[model samples]
Target: MTDLESADRLTEARVALAEAMALHEQGDLVAAERRYRAALAQDYRPADVLPLLAGLLGRLSRPEDALHAWDQLLAIEPDHAVALHEKGLTLHWLDRTEEAIASLERACALDPDNATALGNLGVVLADAHRNLEALRTFRRALALQPDNLHLRHQVRRLGSGAVPFWHIPMMNDAPRNDAFEAAIKAAIGVAGPEARVLDIGAGSGLLSLMAARAGARKVVACEMEPMIAEMAQQIVAQNGYAARITVHAKPSTELAVGAELDAPADILVSEILSSDLLTEKVLDTFEDAHRRLLAPDALVIPRAASAMGCLVASENLAGYAFVGDVSGFDLSAFTAFAPQRLPIHGTMTGWQRLSGDVELVRLDLTQKKHDATLARLSVPVTASGRAIGIVQWMHIDLWDGVTFDNHPDGYHDGGWLQVLHSFPEPIDVVAGEVLDIAAGHDRITLILWPLPRAAD
Candidate 1:
């Protein structure tokens, strides 16, 4: 084409672009879209025209078309940060999560300071259940924009959802914390200051910090939750124990002898137990740790744990255990679907013991191997009442002499709540009768079932 013809075409394209922007601002998206296409057809700065067209298409509720327009811009300018960022958003709108993540990640890499891109990437990652990556991305965005309240809220919100709700309460429980700390100090003392300590499930890096404060030279802690792990790192640094402690944001199963730790640790401290003692896969976690992360003779804190409880009878507790005749209708069948275990605050919940405390099951944490087991137990009734089920609590034998128990009678305001293993139906009995029950564990859950009473 001649120079005169090229200049004439450019003038026409500039006029069309101006008209498109004016129409778009006036809410006439259909007319604006036509003008944008006209400018693009003339190849009048396709890079700039494509973005405007893509954004207009999005406003027109044409996500697929908008995606294609963004792609066209990317084809021309591969590293265009705005194109990549906008394209990522369009892909996410289209439910193309993986592609969105890829585009947003590239945009972030191209413009490391783009807090918007980083925040969008974090949202996608979180939607995909890639919480660890999402948390890290959110943290990076917060670092870039320190005063961004939205970013700060995302960090805290995601962090809370990533970890269990009971963690903060557990940390605040003076009795539990004191017991664990005492056990940790004792273990460090016995293992000597040079002992290598491995703290699995480092919620707030409390155990690892305790190890450091006890003069351990090497401490390695791993938290599966990314947000918690990051906070742990900060807490360790704040406490001036960062130099002696290395926190890995991963599960104990992911740790290696030479990577997260210099060698097999001499002491293993983990508090992954659930209210029922085994629901948190404590067995699986500990087994994996023993096989890979700890020495053969590693000193394990909480060497043993036992679930103890007695037969319980409470009008208030019975209401939660079995339901029947609600508003003159028989809903006893709904009892079959009731919660097998109900967590209750011992001090607040109204209950009475029908039998003295009985050991339901015990786990030997120091053992190298374990398997699921079930055994019979007999509890002599101490009072005659309608037994709903057994209200059980934990007794952790930490170290040799340090022990902790949230016994339903005296222990209150702790993270450990007594769990009621409800029966299928209420049973009545006399004071001198023996109630035979089956109690044990299936490795992942606690088992408690009442046996049939013998005919008189």
Candidate 2:
């Protein structure tokens, strides 16, 4: 065709595409699909029209066609950000996560400030279980658009919920903190207040600053969570311990003994145990520290931790424990995926214990390694009721005299929550009978299992 004829055909194509979109807005998806394909046949860059066409196909549940259109567009415009973004989303819907991440990452890199690209990248990363990097990406998007509620929710959800309220008081638990302080003080005494110290998982930089307060010449602490680590660094300065403490933004694994520190640490103080213990990988962190970082006989804070619990029950909690059919139909099948462990506000959520507190899992931190083990324990019921499960907490035995824990009975309003290790279902029980439970830790997570009630 002549150039004039070619231009006329292009104008006609654009008009036809516009009419097709109007039809689409009028809910005539069939006509829109036809026009979109017609426009594609005109030898135009498919990438220009493919996004809308693919979106329409996806809306119609024709994912196969949508995928084909996107793949074609990608071939034409390899770095097309929209095409990459849409393709990644489609791939994710098709359950191809790794490829989706790669596509989304490419899209984000191509358009660094593209909020949609950043948010999509974050979502894809999170789906792939790369939670840390996902969080960073989400924050970057938020920095561009702070008012984004979706981004805000993702951040909150990714944080695994705010640290339970009782966690702080529990961390400050005198018995726990004093034990560690005593151990720390003793370590500093021998190290002559000049021994360099390394504190990993510096929640509040409390330990490193404590060492400095105790006269250590230098104490370095590392916290992986950026916000927390930054806060620690500031707190050190505000508390007049800045000169003595250095806060590093990293997990202990990221800290090289010689590079991040002058030499092997003379003493190591770290507290990163989750309520169940080891869930925070405290064992792994300490093992790595000892394997290559700490000197022999270096003081390790929280020499031990124990997961304690009581078979608990409350009418208020039964709703969370057992889900029976409304009219005796078998709706129980839906409850199979019920949470094995639930975090409840011990102070805010009113619940009564049907069984006395029992020591379940005890983690000896002094040990270098651990293997999972199951042991039988007979717990006596303290009150009569339907037993839902065991409400568990931790007791961290820190250096010398410091201690920290939310031992449900007395701990309230801190950064940790008493974990309700909900049973698979509820069990009716009477007072004076022993509730059998299985409890231990694989050096990572506290294990609590409700055993079958003996023949009722």
Candidate 3:
């Protein structure tokens, strides 16, 4: 072809490209797509034209066509950050999280300072529940733009998450705190404050401080929770007990005998017992501490604990424990798997004892073997009402005769919520008859089984 013919072809392509842009500006999308494609057919800057056309196709709800356009562009510029980021966002929208994270990560590596890419990476990481890493990335972004309101909100959001309702009630429990404090003082008094004291599960560093106040020369405290440990360290310093207390923010399981505990401790004080008893792995922690960390006959602060409970019924709590019907579906069958041990706010929620607080289960934490045992307990009914089941709770023995308990009768608030050991069904009874029931614990939980009543 002559030069004139080539010039004519070039002129036609440029005119078509201009028409596409004009049509796109005028809201004639179909016409714009047609003109754009016609120009592309004549080879008019395919790299620039393709991305715009693909985006328009996407906006027009034609993902399949848009995918083809993007695929072609990616084939040419494999590491193009824009293409990778957009494609990853599209994949994420499609719920293809695995591929989306990979693509977005690649885009981020290619363009490190890309705020959009970093922000998207943080979002996808959060969606995948990688909270720690997501937190780190968010912090990085905030450092880049400290005044960003959205990032600040995200920081606040995660910080306020998991606001446990039981925490406040537990914190304000005066009786529980008093009991623990007394136990700590008793321990320090017995072992002598000059003894190498090891306080495991240093909650708020309260016990450790008590030891320091009692004049302990060296106090080594380990907190299983990082946040709590940090707070405890602060409290220890604030109270002038920092010289005596060295708080390790880690589980007792992770603490090395000779490393974390400088020397074999003469006293091991820990408050890791769950309301029911063994759920906190107190047995495991104590066994390890006793076996490796403590010297022979080291006074275990909570030398022993007994989970004491009684048989009772409450109309108010029955609703939470059993559901006969929900959304027109018979959910009574769910009662079969209903929690044997239910946590109730004894200090807060409305619940009345149907029977006197009977000793249903007694766990002697001092016993060497804590397998499982059942005993016939004849509980005298103090108040006459329908007995549903045994509502079990704890009576802790910190030292010889030194104790703390949230006895359902009076103890209220502090970290622990009362455990309700719901029975299979309700039993009608009156005052003055001995309600025979199996009451005791397997060290981990309180057992309450109904038995034939003994004639009073």
lDDT of 2 by residue, 311-409 (tens): 877767666666777686877876787777777864437777787667887777666666787898888887888778888887877655566677766
* Candidate 1, residue 246: lDDT: 90
Per-residue lDDT of model 1, residues 270-362, tens digit only: 998888899988999888888988899899988999999999899998888789999999999999999999998644399888999999999
lDDT of each: 0.91, 0.80, 0.75
Best by lDDT: 1
In TM-score terms, candidate 3 sits at 0.74
Clash count of each predicted structure = 0, 27, 6
- What TM-score does model 1 achieve against the real structure? 0.89
When 1 and 2 are scored with TM-score, the better candidate is: 1
Candidate 3 local lDDT, 19-95, one digit each (tens): 99899889888999998898888888888888878887877977768767877789889998888887777777767
Considering summed lDDT, which 10 consecutive residues are worst modelled in model 3? 360-369
Worst 10 residues of 2 by lDDT: 159-168
Task: Please give the ranking of all candidate structures by TM-score, highest first, separated by commas.
Answer: 1, 3, 2
Instruction: Output the better candidate (1/3) by lDDT.
Output: 1
